[model samples]
Target chain A: MSILKVNNLSVSFKQYTSGLRQTTHQVISNLNIELVSGEILAVVGASGSGKSLLAHAILGILPLNAETSGQITYDGEVLTSKRQEQLRGKEIALVPQSVSYLNPLMRVGSQVRSSVRKRNAKQAQEEVFQRYHLKKEVGNMYPFQLSGGMARRVLVSTAMVSGASVIIADEPTPGLDKVVIEEALNNFREFADQGCAVMLISHDIESALKIADKVAVFYEGTVLEVAPVEDFEGKGDRLRHPYTQALWRALPQNDFTWIEGSI
Target chain B: MRWQLTWNIVTFLFWKAIKMASLLVAISFISFLLVKNSPIDPIQAYVGADMLNVSQEQREKIEEYWGLNQPVMEQFMSWSSAVLSGDLGTSMIFRLPVSEVIGERFLNSIALMSVAWVLSGVIGFSIGILAAMNTGTWIDRMIKWYCYTLASTPTFWMGLLLLIVFAVWLNWFPVGMGVPAGVLAEDVTIMDRIKHLILPALTLSIIGVANVALHTRQKLIEVLSSDYVVFARARGEKGFTLFWRHGLRNIALPAITLQFAAFSELFGGAVLAEQVFSYPGLGQATVEAGLRGDIPLLLGLVLFSAIFVFVGNVIADLIYRVVDPRTREGKSYAVKQ
Candidate 1:
């Protein structure tokens, strides 16, 4: 069953192009996607493809200068700003892209614990930290004291500890090593297996496919194709869109072809 | 690791103390030069009406009594030794020990400055938060206008305007002085002292409020837009809960640093405000000492103020360590690793 749905969504920002001149740039236009229980929907795109904007829209954390028009629903109810506020961190949690998102002033342990509203916060935090391969002492450290990999693990642990039904993890594995990356992906896979939905936003479609049940190909601020994970196996034969086929072939293990401008 | 970190911090504080001592010595020597080289004749300034009546020999004797007859280096050495021996010498204007006069004046000044410091910090920080939360609205614009106007205002002119409006026009508070004349000192109540204090304190605080408010507002705006704060909001934090947890803690370090940076400005304003009101505080004494060529009293006030500002800065640094983990733990931990 679908836990979250976005229909005919559009996101634009009012920015100053030059002195005394303001222009509205549409970042995401008429986009559509859904997140279902017991599934991972990987959003794969190059940078600036509006992948993060979708996450921000779903979380209702877009900047003040943003202008958004969309019908977003969670659990069959319209997710208005007020409704989004109510569900955020309880029913939905976000693992943000940048490691800088961790509060520098707060201890990593306390930061993870603050998100746990239903269960024993300390216990939940400790459990997540242990599972994420973080040393118990790492919890007592501030964000600045953490290595890049440690900070990424802490960000992932914050969402994992929240016990939210929907988790949005964005570009969360860049600084991590192979072993840690696999563990993080496996954690998300296990998290989705417990009848919760996961939206993994990434540029690395290769790693995303290891766990993502369905992959949504993002291009030019919109979803060009969202196919089951199996459909991404072969070359241009199975994939519906030319952009999606091009993306698959462009991977080094495949054709490594260049289409130019589609991305 | 923690033990090593603690030792590093202890060493850091020891070095800071040595630095402060060196700074104080430099400040004192510089102040002595400024006072000694000035055009005013200390004896003439001290004697006032009696200067013409004193014989040349008596004038020489008076100069000898104050060590002014010695070589410049000799004068400085004798003064330094006297200071080392715990004597700040006699005030040429007051005819009493400099320390005693400074103590009495400092009590009154401390009350005025302390009140102004706290009032401005609380008031400025609140308006800053208000403006940040209401950015681009009329409320923010109004607060910005008020802070900018106050920022450009002179403390003395502001004091005079407040005096005219509150004392002359309104007759709500006292016109000047710390106490009402002809009233016995024993009979003066706390309310009387507070009433006299209100104008000068308000003048000093209004000037101080502008810098803190503008800086805090700008900092909070940046903090609110930061990725950490945005992530905090995404985690179901909103309203005062969000602000209390994320907003206040993040902006507090900058706010405090800015507040403490205003310490020198606070003293400068106090001098002007005290002059405008004729308040018998250390600021008034400072001006009196400077103009009357009372080197001992002037030097004493300068040293006292330097210590005062140093203590304030130390307190701010301690608070920063408490409120910000990066300053205390991050650098040391990074070093250890």
Candidate 2:
């Protein structure tokens, strides 16, 4: 079933001018996408490519100056600006970059427990806690006590605790070492295996192609192209669009670039 | 576990404060010596013009009576020794013990100041939090305007304005004085004294409330922008829980620090407010003693104000340690933890 779908999503921020003038900067323009249950859709783009902005718009956590106009249907219910946050914890969960969500003052275990209570479920709370290998007393340890890798694990664990059908993670592992990235990618795979719709937003094409069932490329505030992971198999030159071809050639395995001028 | 941590923090803070107090003592000694080295002589003010024309024998007798015949170093030592021994010396003008004079007025000021602080801290912080939560809205704009206006005006001027509006224009409260003369009479009721305290307390509190709100609003803005607040919202915290429980707790450290500074300044500001309202508080006592050049009283008031500031900072530091465990753990607390 289609758990989440975005149709014609566009977001703009109001720009103020001195001397009674004003304008609007359209940050995300005409973004359309869909996610089915138990599928991983990867959003690939470079920095400033509006990937995070799109995720924020979908999460309904955009700034006050941001104006969003689009139709989003999650589980057949229309998504509106007013109800975006309502969908966030229950219908959708967002794992922001950096384990910043884990408040430094609060313990990792308590943070996860809070997420569980917010979901109003007590059954799987312990199960989830144990599955993450979090010490039973870990709730007593504050976020500052956790290592960077441990903090990220706790964040992912908390996001899944609420049983939100869809998870949108932005730049899950941007600058981590290879081992940490592998761990992060494995975490996303586990979430997807739970029959949850997962959207992995990243700039690394190679990382996205690793686990994504469907891959979408974002550029200049729009989804440029999307295809199955199968399409990336030894078909770099056969890609239809110039941007997609550039992206394929830029992958680590395809360092042999026939086209210059940078993807 | 949190209790144990807090207990450790409190003990550690107590030792830190003791160390800080020792430093304050050194600072006080140096300042006393520096002041003594200056041109002003308390003796010159005490000796009458007739004494200069009198015999040196009689002058010497007078000097001995006042303990002025001793060396300057001995005099300062005597003063510090007296202070440490719980004797602030006699008031040169009042012909009364300095401690007695201060004790007479200290309770009144403490009472009035406490009332003013509570009013300001609660009301101001609430307004600030609400305004910040609704920033860009009309309520936020209104609070901004009010806070700016109140914070910019001096407390004395604000007190005067209140006196005019409530006493002269509306005739709702008494003018210039704290309690009525009858209230000081032995037979007067306690309720009457409270009634008289209202105007002075409000006068002192108006500016305090404004300042608190301004500080709280600024700090709340900083806190709300932090990532933790976003995380809380994503955790489905909406409405009152979001603003009060989540947002307020995170922003509390800065707001509390602001409140402590505000509390420290309350004594100094209350002097003017108390004087304007003719309230029999420390400021009024200090002013009366100052006009008469009562050295003991002046020094006592200065010391009291300094002590209040010192205590305020100590409380702020203790609270900071409680609010931020990382602060207790030091600069590398995050890494260490």
Candidate 3:
């Protein structure tokens, strides 16, 4: 069964000014996607490609300015019109791009423990605490005491603790060192192995290629292509679409091939 | 290594406190000595025709008894010695021991200032956190405008307005002063004093609360923008729990430090507000001494005020250390005396 189905989804943000004309900026337009249990879907795009917004719509955590339309079905339930908030921390969990998701004043272990204890079985909670290598006292130490890698681990663990069947992670590896990125990718894989659907949003094509079973390239607030990772190998020139071809070539080749005149 | 560093910090702070205390005492001595060196004598003001017609010997004896006939340096040294020995000398105008007079009034001012301090700190800090949590919304804008207006307006004017509304118009309690006359400490009920105190304390504190609110708002806003606050939000922190538990804990250090500084200011600012309301407090007594040129009384009050400032800052540092233990252990940490 498809864990989550997002059909023809479009989201816009309203901008207002006292004496100036206001406008609506479409952030995500007519986006169609599916996430099945035990699968990893990578959403790849250049910065400002609205990959994060798509994940937010799926998680039902979009900002107030966002006006969303179209159908979103989660776990065979029609997720339309009704607020999608109640599904969060239970049916779905989000790993945001920024590390600021954890309260800085709280200990890493305590926050993560609380996240899972709210919805998790007690046995699973203890297993998670041990798997994360979190000391009992670590839960008492505030966020400032943690390093960047520790923070990322805490965030992922928090999502895992929620016991959501689907986890949406946005740019999980950005600004992290190679070691931290490897750890995060491994953690995502572990979540998928547990029969949970995982959505990895990224701006880096290489990183997306490494872990994604299926890659969805988003451009101009819409999905341009969705294909298996093997399909893109040596087929960059025959991408059939100008935007897709541009994105393929935009990959860092050590020769500085910058895509021009393409959004 | 950490223990050694901590030991060094403690030792450094201990010496620093001693140095500051000695410097303060020396400065007080020098300034008062200069006043004693001045040529003018108060006995001249007291000498009337009856005393003038008296023998020169009697006048000289009178000066001797008052210790005015002593050498300037000797008189200054005696004053300093007495201060060191805990005798602040008798007030020339009030004819009472300066320390005794201050002791009687100190508690009343502290009572007013402490209440105002805690009231403003708690209210302003909470509001600031709330305002920051819902930033960019109407609630945030409302808090911003309210804090801005209160911070800019004069505290005295706010006090007067509160007095007019709560006292003159509403008749909620006694108008001006801490308590009504003939309301003895034993005879007056606790509720009566509280009712009487409500207006002045509220009046004096509102502006302070506003000032604190702005500081707390700014602190919370900065904290919320940090990568960590985003983490908390993602974890499902919402409403008052988010504000108090997450936002408050993060922004508390600065807010608490500001509150401590505000305590010192409370007493200093209370002089005008207290006088306006005819409150029989230390601030009012200090003003009376200033007007009468009561040097001993004035110096005594100034010392007491300085002590309050010093103690306030020390308390603030202690509280900060308690709240954030990392501050005391890190390289960038500030050690308090």
Per-residue lDDT tens digits of candidate 3, residues A1-263? 58898899999998886667788998889899898788889988878878878876776656667899989998788875343656666667888775566665565566776676355444454566568765444455555566677667767877888878888898998899988898889899889888999889998778778877888888889987887777665647546666666667666663335566653
How would you encode candidate 2's per-residue C-alpha lDDT over B1-337 as one tens digit per residue? 4676778877887897787678657755775676566564566556645546768787677789868777877887888888888888888767788888788788888888888888888889889888988888999999989988877778788888888998889988778655576444676677766866788788777778787787778888877777777777776767787776567767777777777866667987889888898988889988876665567777777777777777787788778766775665433433443
TM-scores of the candidates are 0.93, 0.90, 0.83
TM-score of chain A of 1: 0.95
Accuracy of chain B in candidate 3 (TM-score): 0.83
Residue-level lDDT tens digits of model 1 in A103-133: 8788879888889989999999988888877
Most DockQ-accurate candidate: 1
Which residue pairs clash in candidate 2?
none
Give the 10-residue window scoring lowest on summed lDDT in candidate 1 chain B.
Answer: B328-337
**Listed models, DockQ each:** 0.66, 0.49, 0.26
Task: Give me the displacement of residue B182 in model 1, in angstroms.
Answer: 1.4
lDDT of 3: 0.75
| Candidate with better lDDT, 1 vs 3 | 1
How should the candidates be ordered by TM-score, best one leading? 1, 2, 3
True C-alpha contacts between chains kept, each model in order: 0.81, 0.42, 0.32
For lDDT, candidate 2 versus 3, the one ahead is: 2
Model 1 misplaced stretches (Cα beyond 4 Å):
A18-20, A133-138, A233-235, A260-263, B1-9, B64-69, B331-337
Docking class of 2: acceptable
